[model samples]
Target: MAAIDHFWAVIPAGGAGTRLWPLSRSSVPKFLHDLTGGGRTLLQDTRDRLAPLAEDRFVVVTGRPHREAVLGQLPEVAPDLVLAEPAPRDSMAAIGLAAALLERRDPDDAVMGSFPADHVIPDPHGFGEAVRTAVEVARDDWLVTIGIEPTFPSSAFGYVHLGEPVDGHPAARHVQEFVEKPSVAVATDYVATGRYRWNAGMFVVRPTVLLDLLARWHPAFAADLRAIAAAPERLDELWAGLPKIALDHAIAEPAAAAGRVASVPSAFHWEDVGDFDALATLLTGAGSVTVLGDDDLVRPVDASGLVVPAAGRVIAVVGLDDVVVVDTPDALLVTTRARAQDVKQVVEGLKQSGRADLT
Candidate 1:
């Protein structure tokens, strides 16, 4: 695919990823690790996937602590292109800062696509096709989001209710509203209707359009972001006051209600790699032991699970099914696949116990 003209890829690389503990720590988050065993970190994979479309046009918004790591992983991006947040303010502020900067950087015809740094899309071609269509739709001043076709009723992801077909773009649909994550039963009904897609938080919009939409509901917030963009030194002063809210609640949901949002439905395989269960599913099939690191280090007799021998020590699993074992030099996580979501509690406990270094 050829590069999209005036399209800049904005990557937001900030998350604790507590569900993937030991291997994924605050100092080295999930995006920084090779979760897929593909050698490239999730952040690198994200950039590589978008490179064909955005080329050298890239902007990475990350926390101050991980800025150097992001730079190290993606040296193709200039140092100035990586915007570091002084403190964690959530998705809206991080992405809005990119929008505010791009709004001024390219005032006329710049369209920006915001993609999370941690998502794993196996088929880059399919993703590229969807993004191209989204960029085309965004040119008409619509807040376009590339929605994933749900493979199952997933309560973990938000849903985009598909409305009427877009007038000009046949591949695009008018988004009725953005629904928050629902129960499995609710998500089942949504999937059965065939009118909903998982909201992957992948947005393609003109920089000014995004900022202007944000301005409608959050005038001061928008103003502050633009002010920081205008005077870069004021970011520290203005950032603390910015509302700590997600872009969905801050803009996307409201825009959908106002009938200004569009969605490009895609069937590409997308994985957020939220936890060990997800990572295991992505790496291998069920009923088999999958080692993310060196296979020689793992010795499983009757185990069907995932193991990461990061500490380079021999890990032996005996008569266990659907178990998760992640060993690092300082900490080890042993749990069942069924309880992978609860791993975050361990991180919380460690933090409370003054063992922040382990997390």
Candidate 2:
């Protein structure tokens, strides 16, 4: 298939995946790991999913520590396109930098679709269709996002409220608003209306338009990004002073309220793989216990949930349900699926105890 005209895929791969500790670390994040047992890493899978639509027009923004690793995983992407930030400035600075650079490089009406590097979309075709629609909608000066149909009333994800449809774009709808991660009771009500989608953070818009929108809200921040792009030497000097905030808070939410945002409600199965429980659901079918690593190394007796035997040792579990055991060479994590999100507490404890090496 031919590449989408003026469509550029911007991948922001910077999260440490602290929730998935032992397996995903700051040195090597979850995006760099092969969590799905799919042979390729999550970062690789992200590139593969976008290659059909973007072709060679891809740019990945990551932290300096993982710059080489991002390039190593995505060797097909040109080295120049893999931008490395000197520090962690949250999602806005990371993605905004890509937009700024693309605005200067393309200097044309090219749409940039920002997809986090760690997400999992099983149906690439569905994702592509949504992206295509989003891109077309974006060309009309609307900031578009691919919103995932909620598989369940999930309190862990934010919701995108779908509103009236656009005049010409049947596949798109005006975004009523972007809601915070609601309580399960609130989420259930949202799902009942069939007008809410999980905000997957997939944005499609012209780089200039994105920057222009940023300029409206944060004039100085937008100017700094473009100035760095123009000079290419002031990144280290200017990036530190830029506000560290998520893109959603910086622009998406405000834009939605202003009717500048559109939603392409997608049916594709999307997984953020935020923790072991999520990983367990993604890697295996309906089974009592799901082992992501070597099955022979994991000996489960009357156990339920996930076990990852990555350290090349036998992990035996007995008389447990909804348990998660992740065995690494240096660190071993044992927790229940219900408490998987609390693994970051372990990492925090390690830091406090001066056991940063383990973290």
Candidate 3:
């Protein structure tokens, strides 16, 4: 009923996506990749999708190294809107810093929304509408989260159990409980019950309310954040003192336990794009791909469920189903689709073996 102006957005784009190795290296995270054929990076798509709300309203929290990449993709964002983290301190620290910085601009009442820059949302209109609704609901002093309706039993994502429906709103419901990544059996049961949603890690709330919740649940962390916020220039020193914890584990889960959180089923089609398989699903249509190897060999293959990111390199996959075949000049990765989730471990192993070139 009310116009949703004065709403602020924080896009956290600092993580190094190691799972999508070769393509998703430390120098280039998944968010910076042009996974979709639309010629825009995930961060660019995210910004474009939310541009209706105004570029000035957007605030991006990223590491210093990623500042140039983020800026290159999002030229519309003002220089100050991009907050560069001195070091990697996790989501809680990033959120706190963004909220504190935003507070200086608009104080307690301004509504702030945080989203992962690497996510893929197919339905942009529905996503925008859901965000507006969440912003409106956040005005009631509740930390509002946009939860994706689970389409399958996914072990890679966290789950949120929906409680009673929020009064006067059919689409919104009170969050009964929060569950971390569950076993396959548990995830299956959760989907069968139809009372759970995938935790998409998108949150909307007022700065003061979030700070209050953090203070109540985590006093020490809150004090540290407050100190950082007071001396914004020394954020690096303060961040070093802050504990490394996700916002969900540190604040959201605890606040939900105290009966102060709400969730709206995100109507938009969403994907976390955590690994190569998931990334491929987002890229390809039905099932087929055209591969060009050396000598300009035009080979049409039936790639029902495969992720191939090698464009200018020579690649030849004869018999591989549900496999991720990534060929690069320096390294190659061949793994079953199911085991694609372990690519991060492979990256770690490469680092341990001093194979920095592979990583």
Give the candidate number with the greatest TM-score: 1
- Judged by lDDT, which candidate is best? 1
Off by over 4 Å in 1: 285-287
Model 3 RMSD in Å is: 2.7
Which residues of candidate 2, in runs, are more than 4 Å off?
A: none
User: Is candidate 1 or 2 superior in lDDT?
Assistant: 1
The sequence of per-residue lDDT tens digits that candidate 1 reaches over residues 31-104 is 99999888999999999999999999999999999999999999999899999999999999999999999988
TM-score of 2: 0.98
Where does the lowest 10-residue lDDT sum fall in candidate 1? 279-288
Clash count, predicted structure 1: 0
TM-score of every prediction relative to native: 0.98, 0.98, 0.92
TM-score of 3: 0.92
For 226-282, candidate 3 gives per-residue lDDT tens digits of 777778777777777887889998889999999889999775799888887777666
Give candidate 2's error at residue 248 in angstroms. 0.6
